[model samples]
Target: MDPTLQELLDGIGPRLRRIRQDRRLRLEDVAEATGLSVSTLSRLESGKRRPTLDLLLPLAGVYRLALDHLIGAPPTGDPRAHLTPHRADTRTRLDAVVVPLTTYPGRLQVFKQILGPTSEPPVLVTHHGHAWFYVLAGRVRLLLGDTERLLQPGDTADFDAGEPHWFGPANDRPAEILHLFGPHGDRFTQPD
Candidate 1:
């Protein structure tokens, strides 16, 4: 086996023993819960026996931990999604940066949008989704289903994307907002 791999495997015994001790469990207790013999459990913990899935799985269940946790798996890398900010429009001075906030592919997506001065008028368009926007800085102009509203900093709006809606900087100034969109008409409900 490769040295790194061997080192990882060697550490498993000590980790297993530590976790068992941390839980104030003895080898006999673990054996009783995992249906493993006390001697087998002890040998595994003492590195006399190599750890295997058959052994680790039952022990993990008894310890209420994931298999990786039992083995002390190293992190693959940072779990956070890398934020890539992109301009919404390049031809116009109406600068807008859209940064995706969600990592997984799903019906509900989130974005942090920053809009600069817009010389053109707001063009309303309709689509199939539910949208919620929270203004974080400056002011925003929201046109939804024939109604128009000016949202200031800290203001929020939730509406069906199927309705004709448009939003941008309220005036010739910059604005930042958090936008949550559900492509399949998913609604955002506050947890009870």
Candidate 2:
């Protein structure tokens, strides 16, 4: 086995023992719950036995944790933001998410907005915040009540959510934009 891989596997045994002790559960109790032999559990926890799916599955259930959480795997180098995306409507490819949900109010909430060509008529929604958006690549057609304009790449726009508005891709193409939503009472204003 590779040195790093061997070290990683070796560390899990001690972690398992620590978690079991922290939970104040005895080997016999865990064995009875998981239907695994107490001796086998002890050997596995003591690093005398190599960990396998058979051992890990029952152990994860006993500890009330996912297999990945129990093993402590390293994170993948994904460039995508950590935001959990949600679709507003299938007709309009409006993908959005609130960043750092527990963050303090008034701080900027970042979002990556992707709108498809079919996304239109903006279905103006009311919310308690202001928003500023910058087009990253494609064009975003903004409909702020009577005002309508096409924002091209590198263009930015800001507006109050209280104002009825709608937005979608211009020229029937997909659009990507970065939005910074502000807290209540902070009205977004465009640079004149």
Top of the candidates by lDDT: 1
Clashing pairs in 2: none
Model 1 residue runs over 4 Å out of place are 1-78, 90-94
RMSD to the hidden true structure, all candidates: 10.3, 12.2
lDDT of 1 by residue, 1-192 (tens): 889889889999998999999999988899899899999998998899999999999998999998877898875655676689988863333579999887656668889999987788777788888999899999998888779999999999999988888888988889999999998899988899
lDDT of 2 by residue, 1-192 (tens): 888777889888888898889999999989998999999999998999999999999999989988867877555564555566665553333544323322334666777777767733456655667878889878888988789999999999888877777777886777888877787746565499
* TM-scores, one per candidate: 0.56, 0.51
TM-score of 2: 0.51
